[model samples]
Target: MNTQMTYTAFLDEQCLASGPLVDVATAIQQHANQSNATVLIFNDQTGKQIDLDISGSKQDIQQRYAEHPETVKKVGRPKLGVISREITLQQRHWDWLDQQSSSASAVIRKLIDKELNDPNSESNKMLAKQATDRFMSAMLGNMPNYEEATRALYQGNKEVFLDLIRDYPKDIYQHILKLSAYAF
Candidate 1:
């Protein structure tokens, strides 16, 4: 199964359809044909609006995929583009890391990977909030209760945010929920 993430499509500020990412372009096209509406596709995970060109024929798409053969490498360890960087650390922290592993570099890399995978990490939460803020600014800046919604979003008040966006178009409201899902 191709377990791609879901995406929501907005046509003329209303939710037209939402489904697997691959089908979003087709949905947008269909909605546009019916009403001549502007289409925007928002990724559910990242809260970023995506631009897709569904204008090419099947053969063209196939040819394009064929040209980018690196995308289909066999399942195994991929190439690591490692670069060296100087990191200054406190003596106690460096000592602790040295006690944990053979090499300080390995410990540092492991720590970075762990933090990156931790959704509840402070850095990750901040990133999620920033993404939510950007999405709100782009999609709801001119809405009926923009300031209150933005305040609620920053304060991590889901109920207030939901109530504020109650009158928004379905797609916008749902997209906000998806974007701020990690905020609280």
Candidate 2:
């Protein structure tokens, strides 16, 4: 996991902490010591729940969760923030790549960067919707009008979605809006 990534923790419907992993862990530990409520942690960017070992002292927990440098270097230039990964392409695609002046990796990177940088791209919208949906499913599945809100989300009806979830817990409602800002 990236140490720079932010995390959010909730004790049921109430958000307990939202920040870097170490700080969230410390807050969760404190909350756990005081109450028996189950604290669920999530990766803010992906809206995915994650489990962390928070059994020891704050320093110990931080050390345990800290992002460690890879012991073995891989194929790409790690210093330049590049890590090589395998990709499967059809023979015709490989043939076209082989004829290009630039390396296959460079061309692939350009295409990927273009798609990622486009704010109105379908892929970006789909990702935002998925992230929002995942978080809603986990946190507000039982809330009133959840199904309607989900339908409105996929249909790109921001007004109806917001209206449906307006009466929900403030933290969850705000987080949904934040996650789904680009979903439409």
For every model shown, what is its TM-score relative to the native structure? 0.68, 0.85
Residue 60 in candidate 2, Cα distance off native in Å: 1.2
Q: Give the best candidate by lDDT.
A: 2
lDDT of 2 by residue, 1-184 (tens): 1225788998888889998888899899888889988888988768889998889898898887766776677777876678778999999999999998999999998888888777578988888788888899999888789999999999999889889999999888878887787788
Cα lDDT listed for each candidate: 0.70, 0.85
Q: Candidate 1, which segments miss by more than 4 Å at Cα?
A: 1-6, 16-21, 29-36, 58-93, 102-106
lDDT per residue (tens digit) for residues 69-165 in model 1: 2544544333453456688989998889879846887788788888877777776666667767777777878878988988887787879978988
Clashes of each: 0, 0
Name the regions of candidate 2 deviating beyond 4 angstroms.
1-4, 99-101
